[model samples]
Structure formats: structure tokens, C-alpha cells
Target: MKSSPLALGLLALGLLAPSVRAGLTAGMQEGKVELKSISQLAFGPEGVLFIADPKAAAILAVATGDTAPASGSATLRAEAINEKIAALVGTKSDDVIIEDLAVNPISRRAYLAVSRGRGPDAVPLLVRVDVQGQPELVALDRVRFARAELPDAPADVAPAAGRKGGSPRTESITDLAYADGRVLVAGLSNEEFSSTLRAIPFPFSRVERGTVVENYHGAHGRFETRAPVRTFVPYRIGGEQHLLAAYTCTPLVQFALSELKPGARITGKTIAEFGNRNRPLDIIVYQKDGRDYLLMANSSRGVIKVAAEQITPAAKSITAKVSDTDGLKFEKIDWAGVAQLDRLDARHALVVRTGAGRALNLETMALP
Candidate 1:
């Protein structure tokens, strides 16, 4: 995600808010490869960390188990999990760009959000690729990923407009997640700030054709404009299923799964807010030592950590700003994607730094 000077100015103003206790500081260890551009990341079972390198046309994997290096040294090294994933779909890398990454907790399979072109002709798609098997890539549009049982649209919303590619059809999917045999996709628009969210109830490996579950416009609240929703993660709050969504143009938005159902009317009461003016590039939820944390990667702020408890709708803000005299502040890092992993007794994470060079640099941080 690229940040403009105007956006940075807004973030500086946001820092003026009341200060709170700064989160724990974690040791940072850089990765091996220089990632030109990364989309998203996820940590699989055991100690495997998966990174989506769209520009490189491959997925990078790192093992952060006992084999990791000692302290002060880079613990993660980028290895190509599989190359030419787009080729598997009979398309060349130039014709398709990988945009998002998701890992299924139950199936242990990784999914990629692929976009097909550079212009309006570009068709956005969701594909599931095997990380452990022969590494086959299958498009979700080919098969139903899940059962669709959404409410009927209001009579005011014309039927033709309610169909996909209607008045406000999404052109890109920025984030994806699979859980309980259902896939949640976050739609982003390059021409507009608002985005859409859809839930597909089927396995990625079997999706035959593209399906629409729900479309969220910005009419619900002040934070609900046509902002570019960059990431989405499924989080369990107080034992209830909810969705944590972040945008690059606005603050974060949270809502229950029930409220996100297709054709379901949602309002400010159904949404929770987080983050500041800084554009959030990616987000991940990790549990360490029985404690849960929300890790966010901001374009201007390297990585910000917040306790899960502070994510309530009542919280005044999402993160607390810290002072630095050595200029060792978050601005020094150009973060693209982030992931959290558990390696033995240590909690590890990998962050992809973009625009620095050709190879993807993975930074390992020790979780407190």
C-alpha cells in the first residue's frame, strides 16, 4: 500500500490524541529475501509462515521452529513454496496478479485472491492453492464454496442492480479467509473508497463459479463510506463470531457475522471502529501464551500491537503513539504484509517490507 503526503499529515494529527501506555516492545529480526511487493501473510499449524509475493509470482515459506537462528540474527528465510501458480490456471503472470492470501485452519490449505488484468477488463477471482499437496490452483468461481442463504434485497434496490457487475460491482478482492467450510472475501475498489464483503459457503478447492454473499456500502456509519477495505480477519469476541475489517482510506470497521449476512441492513450500532488515520495494509490475529493480540501493519507505522480487550466499540482509539529520539520510529519501516507464528516457547512473526529492494525482507519479532 502506498501512502501520500496528505495521508501522513492526517496521521501526524491523529498522534496528538491522549496518550496511553505503549505496548510491549518486541525484538525485530529481518528476513532474507527482498520482497518487491507483498500482499498478505499467514502462519500455518506448527511453525510454517506463508507469504504472498504477487510481484514475484510465488508464495514464500519460512520455517521458524527449532531450526531458526539465534537471537539478533534473522530467523526466517524466504523459500519459494510454489512458482507459476497463475500458470496453473492457464494464465501468464502478466495476465494475472495475486492480491491476497488466506489459510484455512481446518483444511490447512492456502488461498490466493487473483486479479486478471490491468484495466476494466480485469476480472477479479478467488483461487485455492494446495500448500502441502501437488500445489494445485483452483478457481472458486468454478464451484460453490458454500451455501448462500441471504435475505432478499429491498424493493427499492432494483433487481438488476442487485446482481453482480451491476451498479457497484467490486473489481478486486483484497483479503480472504476460510473457516468452518465458509470463505469470507473483502472486496476493494480502485476507483472508489467504499468496499464490499461477501461470504461464500464452500471449500476453495471446489468453487466452480463466482458468487455474491453480501455487499456493504458506506451508508451505515461515518466510517462506512466507500473506503478501500484492505484487509479482513475473522475474530471470536467474547465467544461470539465477528469480523474485523480494516481500510486503507478510513479507520477499521467491525461487525458480527449475523449482521454481515447478504441483504441484511446494518447501521452504526452494528459496527465497531479501530486504528487511526494511518492506512492499514494488513492485519492478523495471533494467540500467544493464552493471550490474544491484534497485529496491524501500517504504511507509515511499521507494526502496531494492541491487546484484544482494547478492540471494543467503546475504545476511543486503536493504537497508542510512542516517542522516539533516535528516529527509530515506525516511519523507518515500509511494511506491506504481516503474520504471526508460534515457534516452540517463543512467539514469532514475519513482516514483508515493500519498495526497499528486489527481494522480500522478512522481519521476525519476538512477541511478549
Candidate 2:
């Protein structure tokens, strides 16, 4: 194989380091991070960790400095993860709440967003799981980090429409993901169209208002705009980047990345209605036998494996009422009580699920 002239020029300009070339950390500053809360976590290039602080209406990008390429097999299993985290934090197992889990693609290490307590004063902490499945706190004492504050976060005092005593502000950021040098944030905003999806460029520039999004819910027999996306994953459809977002009452919608412009209102294509009265907790995209699939964890529904081949460019939208699951057929996996998940390797997934005695457990399972 021979290097092309463009490759040689790029090498000379040091553009091979995708992160540096894209200014992933160009404007970041080194300091201690004061996180008010940890609602979600995602990993970008060069071990940069994106933490969502919904309470603070901000997103922090921390350079985790865990970029050493993983060696050998990265399979992991840790039973009773809640107890382990409680023991590590000197709290009761029942008080430990794991909010989210993300695996560093480069290091293959798992990082968790945890709440040490279950009350309003609960302390937020980030924990790292070693190759041996041991939980360790990630110190925020002095690290390179950048913060992006949402300019139009909902009012913290406003009570949610249906949930009594629940503040809409707390749902300002429900999910976070890194894709193609941008951080995609899904949650509610103060704008008239509360439900929003934001795409923020890396290196922390001026945070802009999010793109308002709406979707037709087949199970509900109506369109909804105020409900935030519970979970979503970036996927390619017909060779173009798009987001596959799952919302409460289980509607799977698709939005093109190019259409998520600032302050724009867009209607997503509803491709599937998984069911009703269920919340999508997490989602991961993987490939098997040269075909892509979506592994989703739900609150009431068990894990499901959805074939990505059905999301073709000409796929019809599910607009009518649904009795059960409709559009883009799925196979329910035997996995039960799954709360959070991430891809650990090419052939395995790291999942946190309830085990005996309702205790949470972390384990890696083969991609079905």
C-alpha cells in the first residue's frame, strides 16, 4: 500500500489526531469541576468524557486521560454493583443510584454517573470500572475540562404538567451523545416548543438554542412535542448520519443530522411504536453478520433487538394507532431488568440490570 499525496499532507499538518485536528479540546481549561449533578455520560475521542448536569443546565467535557488502547479481551462481569458502589462510597446499597453508564471506545473501560444518596441533597460522583470490574471514583480535583451552559434551560421552579412536585428544569438534559465532533443533547428547553435536540460543536463555543422537535406517537394516536426523548443513538441511514430517538410510551423516531439547525422546528419520522406506558432507558447500535441492530433497554419491556435494515430511506411512517409493537419488527431478548447499557466491544455489550433481591448487577453479554 502507498500513501496518497493528501495523506502525506495531512500527516505533515498533524491532522491524523482527529481530536486535535477538530479542536476537541482547543478551548478547554485546566481546573477543578464543580458538578451539581450527573444525569448522563458519553465519551468522545481521546478519552474526553462528556457529563450532563441537568440540574445545573450544563454539559462538561472532561479529559479523562484514559486513552491507552485496551489489550486482549475486555469482557467484564461484576455482580451486585450497587452494593459495591455503596461500600466504596460508605453508603447503604439502597441509597446508591446509577444514572448512566458509558464505555470509553478507546480504553474499553466503563464509567458510571452515580448519585450517592437518593434525596434532593444527593451527591453526584463519577465512577470508573477497571478491567477487573472494580469500581473506583474518578477524582474531579484538577483536570482539563470545558463547560457549556444551556442558554434556554427551562425554569427550575415550574412544575411539570402532569407530574406533581416534579420540576421541568430537572429534565433539561435527559441524554448526551458524541458523534462526528459534535455533542448531541436531548431534553427540554424554555422555548415554546419545549422538547429539543441540540448539536453543539466541540471545543466549547457559545451554546445556542436547540432545535425544537416533534413526533407522532402511534400508541397515543396523536403528535407530541413536549415529551423529551428518553434515550437515543446515532446511526447511519442510507449513508447519511441520523439520530434514532426513543421516547416515553415508546415511539422510535428518526431525524437527519443536517436538519437539526439551531432554533429550527422539525418533525421526525416515526418509524416504530414499541408500546405504551414504557420508558426507553438506553440504546446501543451494533453489527452482527454484516447487518446492524439496535439493542434497547426499557422500563416495563424487556430488552429488544431491532433490525436496522427496516429503517431504509423508503420506510413508511407509523401514524395510525397501535395495539402493541408496530413498524420495524423487533425480537425481545431474554435480558430482564436492564437499566443502562453500552457497547463493551465488537461482539459484547456491558449492561446494568437488576438481579436477585432487586440488587443491580453489571455484566457483559454477547450481542444477539
Candidate 3:
């Protein structure tokens, strides 16, 4: 969902100045580039790979060279998604851990990030799974990449290190989405001690900016929290475009697109709070039977489906925590263990979830 820049100078730039996009051929910069950790990812035009390496305190957009047109034919079939993935990563069925899933809009292929071992010794690998459920390593050789840096990112500090740390950054990129020629990223910030949403133009064609969004959690001034947004979608409500973002303790908030200027401190209008303890993982807006709905995937809880008819500019923010329905009707999918989800097409969604026992599986199913 982002990139890491060289120094703090570029991050301080405004809209008037233009700079050359930092480009890298994947394997060529191996010695100089280390993706210590990959928390979130998204794809852009011309096979551009947006990788969020929170541990390294930077985001890198890698040119993967996977420009083939997507089959766009029909849904893919993965008979035993987990077993196949385990074999490809050279890990036993029990040793495999599927972290996240994303479908490329252009290639229509599903990508999975997996860990081969446990704890700090685990090895992470990116696997490309096709329509037939076949898995292959996404080659990083000879690929082009760009970096965007977040200044003053909290360093990954070990408790025993006595405050001295590596890189002054350890923030995580919670979610990523690409739309309208820009990449939208949501995550927590260690430097500012607040949640942030960033809109970066494609191909590193311009400067990058980060926005600090604050919102009230409970009653107006009784209790408030600047929690990080877990996931979000760029959508239009009441004929006006906005960023519909979800935060921890699950508050659905909206910010008008026009108000997201750099250096502007914005307050989100909290529209709905799903529950007290639930955390949202991913959210996608879709249409069905000539009606619109907001499908949100959650953690521990279940998938929630809210009718779009309930979302409107007239809807007021929930200032107080409630026990029941909050002006909107919602339904939970019957299936459990759906850890990750994304829109595959108009009527289908690609999900990566825990399968039998401890195994993981990726499958496409009709929208609820």
C-alpha cells in the first residue's frame, strides 16, 4: 500500500514540487534492500507492487512484470488450497501459516503471504495461486521497485535494549486499497501517536503525504480515542465521494474526499459502531439485486453485511455506545474463521481463512 523514501527532506515537500520516482530492479537491490517484514500489499497499473514493510519503516512499490491480462473468465477452483500451498512453500501442512490474501485486478491471480516456520525463526514467502489452485513463488528477480518513507516512525525496540533500537520505526500498515489513480493506506503512527491515512499517487509520479485523522469514540466528550483505522474503502455516499473507514472498537466513519488535503487535521464523522470488542479486518462495497451493501470481514467475530440504503449523508454519527442496532440492519455470514477477504468480481469474493483443524484455505464464493 506504500513506499519508503531516502531522507526526511522529501517527506516535508508540498504539492508544487515534483521529484523523480525512485525505481529499483528487484534482485539488483537485494544487498541494499531488505524487506525485514511485509504487513500489507496492493497492486497498481503495469504490475506495480505496493509493499508495506513496517519493520523497515518504509513502503516499496515493486514492478513485478506480471502484465498479462487476467483471464476474467470465471471463478477459480482451489480444491485443497492449504495443502497445495504447504507443498509449494516446502513446509509441512502443520508448519504452514497463511497470513493474508490479495487478488490482482489485472492478472486475476490470487497472491498469498505465508510463513514456513514458527515465531522469530519463520521464513516468509509470497505465493501466486492460479485458477487451478497451483502455487508458485512470485519471483523478485529483475523487478523494479520504488520506496516511500514515513518520517519518525517508531523504532522496533526490544524491551531489553534499554531504549536504543533499529531504524526508529516499527509501525504496521493495517490496510491498502487502490482507486482513482492513487493508493490509499491506513495504519497506526508511532511518531505522532495517532492513526493515519495516506493517499499516494501511482508510479511515484509525485510527492507522498500522510493525513492524521481523529474521531470521537464514545459520547461527545465523555470518552474519546484516536484509534488506528483497521480497513477502509473509497466510496460515494449521498452523491458525494468519501473515504469510509473502520476503526478498532469498530466505528464506521466517513471523511469527504475533498477535505483530505495534506497537513490538514481532519475529524471523521462517526456513523456506526458495530460493537464494543470487535475489530474490523477488511471492508468492500458491492451491489446485488439492484441494491448496495457494505460487507465487512471481522476478527474473532463474523462477517457483517449492512445494506447501503442505510448509509447516507443524513445519517448521524453514533455519539454514545449502544447495545443493539444503531440505525442500520446487519447480518453475519454463517461461516466462521474467515480471516481475510477481498472483492474478486461483481458477485464473488476471495477469502483466505482457517480450514479444518489448523490448516488454511483460499476460496471464492458468492457474495452474501
All candidates in order of TM-score, best leading: 2, 3, 1
TM-score of each: 0.50, 0.87, 0.80
Model 1 clashing-pair count: 25
Question: lDDT winner among the candidates?
Answer: 2
* RMSD in Å for all candidates: 16.3, 4.6, 6.8
Worst lDDT run of 10 residues, candidate 2, spans 210-219
Regions of model 3 farther than 4 Å from truth: 1-34, 71-73, 93-95, 154-169, 189-193, 205-222
**Model 2 C-alpha lDDT versus the unseen true structure:** 0.82
Per-residue alpha-carbon lDDT of model 3 for 208-294, expressed as tens digits? 544434433443336666667788888888888788888775678878877766655666777776766677888888899999998
Clashes of 2: 0
Q: TM-score for candidate 1, please give it.
A: 0.50
Per-residue accuracy of model 2 over 1-368 as CA lDDT, tens digit each = 12578866887888775544444666678999999988899998888999999888888999998888888777888899889999999999999999999999888999999999988899999999876778999999999999988655444454466677654344557789988767888885544445677788776766443344443333344754555677889998999999999876468888788887755666778898877767898999999999999999888778888999999888878877767778889988988889999999889999999999958999999999
* Candidate 3: 10-residue stretch with minimal lDDT: 22-31
lDDT of each: 0.45, 0.82, 0.69
